[model samples]
Target: MGKITISQKGSRTIYRVNRRIVCYRDGHKYCVGKPSSGSTNIEFDALSENIAHERCIEICERRIYADMKYQNPVAYNAHKVLNALA
Candidate 1:
């Protein structure tokens, strides 16, 4: 199981998704460390307001579910929904 962490960078607070020992940042929401099939940097910027925090939560939750996709069908389907939302 991987852990998601929240840390402060100067005055800005950033989120990190640690999956398989790889640390992924908020602005860079792609996981290049695991599942090496496809990894693309996801942009999480909002002009209206700071949507980074929300995106980080969504992404991390989706990933956590995705990691356990095989064992639990419910969580897998829920992961699909979250993936769609994200």
Candidate 2:
């Protein structure tokens, strides 16, 4: 897999997976929350739903202005959670 880019869209941040965008709203939306200020990598594919939920919670708790550099942690974490659910 490749890296997913998280971008700001108004008050919420979006994750770019392949060509699809995932958010935290709606029933189908697996991951939701404000992304780290800079960038972060999440090991989504290897994470569990519980882990994903924890990661999302962590992201939600993060300061909006804090700088994040890796994307694997969030991406892979989400991927794992979503994959298990799917």
Candidate 3:
């Protein structure tokens, strides 16, 4: 999995993969990389924030679900959720 970073410049936010330029804008969420020359930058601050936050929540949920699965394998099927979280 690639690491994600968020940066803010003036009113714009940039999302990068490793350190190479990806996308820039005035929001928290953006496409993971740079657009082709002459292309417009895409901003998804709300979606980005939602995805980031949802991943965090899914992490916690996975832990709990894992414990339950271990305690009673037949009663839980959290692998799907955990995979989605990842």
Candidate 4:
């Protein structure tokens, strides 16, 4: 069974895979975290849909940021998340 799904609402793309939720809102530069449990707030782990795997690109950037340095964390993280989809 597939746990992933994509939806559109007024030019927004919503992604849901199991307990994780990712939303690319209109005019938003990056992925913003929203409460998948539908309570109040969401945790950091929910973001990126878990691209933190050892072979994932997210891990690459994270390591680079630690070694070299990162200029923009928001855009950097977003790029990693979106890149995994690509």
**Reference-based lDDT, residue 28, model 4:** 35
Would you list the rank order by lDDT, best first?
3, 4, 1, 2
The estimated TM-scores of all candidates read: 0.31, 0.26, 0.32, 0.30
Whole-model Cα lDDT per candidate?
0.48, 0.47, 0.51, 0.51
Q: Return the clash pairs for model 4, or none.
A: none
Q: Candidate 4's residue-wise lDDT over 1-86, tens digit each?
A: 44877766554566766654455543332343343556443454444434322223344445666544366778777776887999
Model 1 lDDT, full chain set? 0.48
Candidate 1 regions exceeding 4 Å error are: 1-50, 71-86
User: Which stretches of model 4 miss by more than 4 angstroms?
Assistant: 26-86
lDDT for each residue of candidate 1 in 13-77, tens digit (9 for 90 to 100)? 54445522222444435322333314433322121113443455567776666668867988788
The collision pairs in model 3 are 12-25, 13-25, 22-33, 22-34, 29-45
Give residue 62's lDDT in candidate 1 (0 to 100): 69
| Residue 65, candidate 2: alpha-carbon lDDT | 17
Best by TM-score: 3
Candidate 3: where is the Cα deviation over 4 Å? 1-43, 77-86
lDDT (10s digit) by residue, model 3, range 6-58: 76555455565642344433222334322234444355444444454444445
Q: Kindly provide the TM-score of model 2 when superposed on the true structure, using C-alpha atoms.
A: 0.26
